[model samples]
Target: MKILLPVDGSECALRAVDHLIAHAAWYREVPEIHLLHVHPPIPIGRVQAHVGEDTLKAYYLEESQASLLAAQQKLDAAGRFHTTHIHVGQPAEIIAKMAKDLGCDLIVMGTHGRGAVAGLVMGSVANRLLHSAPCPVMLVR
Candidate 1:
């Protein structure tokens, strides 16, 4: 099975990795894990101001890479077969798109993320993926 694991370097997100590691043998075969980190979009106004477009883009890439690295470390420690991706967009949208694009059978992610009021207002990544994902979704709380 192919499993898409969306993470934001949050403890809650890492919990999903922990859950997968603890339950690896439940699946009939060793699953291929896709670890995804979606970076927040750069502000358009800032891109036109003090920060050049290239610089802002570089910043986003760098941040996303860092997040991916952290996630890789966790997955590595767990001895799982996985690949990392860094995307720039809304987390929920990017996650859903990536899962569809990659033809993943399922998504394993955290229910609560880093956002405060926004997460509560618009719903968390897990909630959005649960309602919108094309495949099955497993939320780790």
Candidate 2:
């Protein structure tokens, strides 16, 4: 099975990663893992205008790479072979899109575990992905 794992470097996100690592042995065949981090898009006009396109791109790359580091280290330590990706956009949208593009059979992600009221007001990425993702989504808090 191909699993798409999205990590934001939150304790919750790392929890999801840990869960997957522990359960990996349950599967008959080792699954292919795709690790992804989605950074919010650069502010519409100001940051891009000030930094220039190339510099803005560099900034996005740096931040996203940093966000992925903890998860990457854990995977490395476990000797798990996987591919990593970074994108700038709405996290839910990017995650759903990436799963489809990569032909992932399942999506395993972490949730921030907001209260229902807070989630309804601020919205939840995991909730959005549940509706938008083409494949099954497993959310770990």
Give the per-residue lDDT digits (tens) of candidate 1, residues 1-141: 999998877777878888988999999999999988888776687557788878877898888777667668877987887988888898888898999999999898878777553465433677777778989988887
Local accuracy of candidate 2 as per-residue lDDT tens digits, 12-53: 888888988989997789999999998878677776556788
Candidate 1 displacement at residue 57 in angstroms: 2.3
> Which candidate number has the best TM-score?
2
The number of residue pairs in model 2 that clash at the backbone is 0
Candidate 2 — which pairs collide?
none
Alpha-carbon shift of residue 77 in model 1 (angstroms): 1.7
Candidate 2 wrongly placed segments (more than 4 Å): 113-123
Candidate 1 ranges with C-alpha deviation above 4 Å: 118-123
Query: How big is the RMSD of model 2?
Result: 2.8
Candidate 1: residue 113 Cα off by (Å): 1.2
Per-model tally of clashing residue pairs: 0, 0
lDDT of 1 at 49: 75
